[model samples]
Target: MLLRRGILWLTLCLPLYGETVAGRWHAAVKTPSGEEAYFDLEVNHSGGEWQGMLINGRDRNVSSAGSFDGRKLRLEFNYWDGRLEADFENGELRGAFTRQSRKQVLARPFRARRTPLVSPASAPSVDAGGEWILDVGEGGGKEMWLASFEQDGARLQGVLIPVSGDYGMHTGFVDGNRILLTHFDGIRATILDARISDGRLVGTLKGSVSAMVTGRRPDKAGRQELNSSSLTTMKNPREAFRFSYPDLEGRVVSSTDARFRGKAVVVSISGSWCPNCHDEAVVLRMLYDRYHAKGLEIVALGFEYTGEKERDLRQLRLFAEKYKLPYPVLLAGTTENAQQTLGQLRNFRVYPTTLFIGKDGLVRRIHAGFEGPSTGARYAALQQEMTQWVESLLAE
Candidate 1:
């Protein structure tokens, strides 16, 4: 009866296990590199399935779900550029995340505790309205542009307009003094020890792509100057290039058209898979609304990852449907050869590039990446300056 005695002892320990996991538990999470992060948790029972969500520290309402089994937990979700799977045990949570061509594991220990529902006063009143800018070193380093933060009930979420590239959206919430934000690049970060002061949200925001970058109010004059210089530095305005792409209906649209007569044109080289392109599309829509009556037309050329030309066109059309694009989109070849597809175009490396052709049919500007209107105060100033530039060009 020795085996029977062992079974009886195991049954007694199971009751203690059940008691240990009767309530909810939470913790601040981060990747090993300390860039991507989130607020994670589990609500479980000893012998029952446990369920929880990993909330975006920046945008509280943006969350993904997970499961737990008493002493163990696993979370599966998507972030800006990667997929995540975290494991939890005892009073700690850790795991590995993979994306693009990289992989990362949880290097640090995350302490687990029960997170009580924060009252209204404890939540952050982040007036993210003003223009914001992120400076993340060089090499076209990572940068974020936040337009504003919106509140709904006890929840908060904001849109992030990226300046560096076409990273989809950065959404999150402000839990007490902590900021939990996630990017479209498949990464998340929690900025602990945050506080508001002087009508601006001042705090250290962390991420997997960069270190603990600080967020603050953007300077107006500096932003204006930056925009002016960036827009005015076009070295080759006399350059001319040819473009031929098929529209959504399998019809070919080219740069050399008799209807062009003497009018300026904006050609957008983008794809539906890009988030930066989304921001650019919205801003372009706004501009088109203001200037389409002035004989200005925009053509969106999508270079998608899918090999089929028809599939690429459908995807582009879907993206247009979702965003209510006002311009006509064309599908280029699916060879991943953007420069080749542009025929005689040069220096075409970046995606979501914009080519501004003057009334004379000569390229005036080749903007490399799209910095949406919501990046922050700097982006606002940039938009104002850009509007003036566009008006001047149109008047000329």
Candidate 2:
């Protein structure tokens, strides 16, 4: 009887034992550039000690790990091509944290609920699959812009393919009578917030948000041109201007170089603090190396997170050196908001934006996001199509 009572008492104390900042938590990191990243941290207690692992956020997967020592929390996660440190509030398991290199602030820290992390809704029985046009609305019921959504239900995890834009992985979920789909541009927002009606879902949106996104999910029709416009013509020329910045070796390079004088120059715009940029950078490097001899030169411009130009340069240097980037990388600025950084300089659209600078120095094909090979047959075909574009440009 005494042993049974002791066992019951220990079981009741288990919850109290984990009161020292030692449990799962949901965290979001916001870059000064206005990009929000999501993360799920699993913290475990062993021998009165705590440790953690960060799940997927932005382009980073489950490879992130860290330790919590009462007041000081230290975590290492990959960003761009370098590992970044995240420091938690010394003693508390909650509160705002900063990415060391970029100084991006991650606020609204909260303990993750231990309940099943499922959406509080059901999947509608409609064939929400296939490519459907998306028309976002603003106040007064005005249709703002056009985009696309590809619903695979399983693979590709259902993505929002914006028309002539790019904000990678626009995910959706259905709750009760409402259908909610969202993407991050430094914060989580309801890109689509329509409730289920007769057959479809309808809702309002935040307009300024979509203007910054330029991602697209290619249709699986086997390298077919969905849009007839050549990737080398500047549809928005006046808004786009050309500039130059120095690479790590003090080499001053610009979008107006003779090497890219008459060729299609691809300006790869991304931040060194971005995980998605890592994959995009590798692929861009491969494409640049494979096609440079054939009138193809990629100028990678990094919009890093440091508050100072020198720090931004250093971060960019680290990324370039680590990735062995053969292409020239210029430092844009340390600002986190893309609009403030590029909106004033040029008509910059999105991160990981590939601006195809034509022979006339005019912006041409602007491809957004890198749908890696693992994304399946569509990605493979997309790769082939892009390669074909390069081949055509080379022939020109």
Best candidate, TM-score-wise?
2
TM-scores for the candidates = 0.54, 0.62
The lDDT for every candidate, in the order shown, is: 0.54, 0.52
Candidate RMSDs in Å, in order, are 9.4, 7.3
Clashes of 2: 16
lDDT of 1 at 156: 47
Question: Can you write out model 1's per-residue Cα lDDT over 71-183, one digit (the tens) per residue?
Answer: 44444432222234444444444555443321223333344555532224565555443344544334565444433455554354454443344233344555555544444
Could you tell me which 10 consecutive residues in candidate 1 have the lowest summed lDDT? 224-233
Q: How good is model 2 by TM-score?
A: 0.62
Error of 2 at 123 (Å): 7.4
Clash totals, every prediction? 31, 16
What is the per-residue lDDT of model 2 for residues 1-396, given as tens digits with 9 covering 90 to 100? 999999999865544444545566555444333433444556665675445555432322332445554344554443322222343443334444334444754442333334323353555544344443444544563322333344444211244433233344445555555544444322232244455455454555442244222222234533323231332234356544466777767788776567767887777777776544665677778788898887788778787775576667777877786678888888766546656645523444445666666666666466655554323454566667677766766665
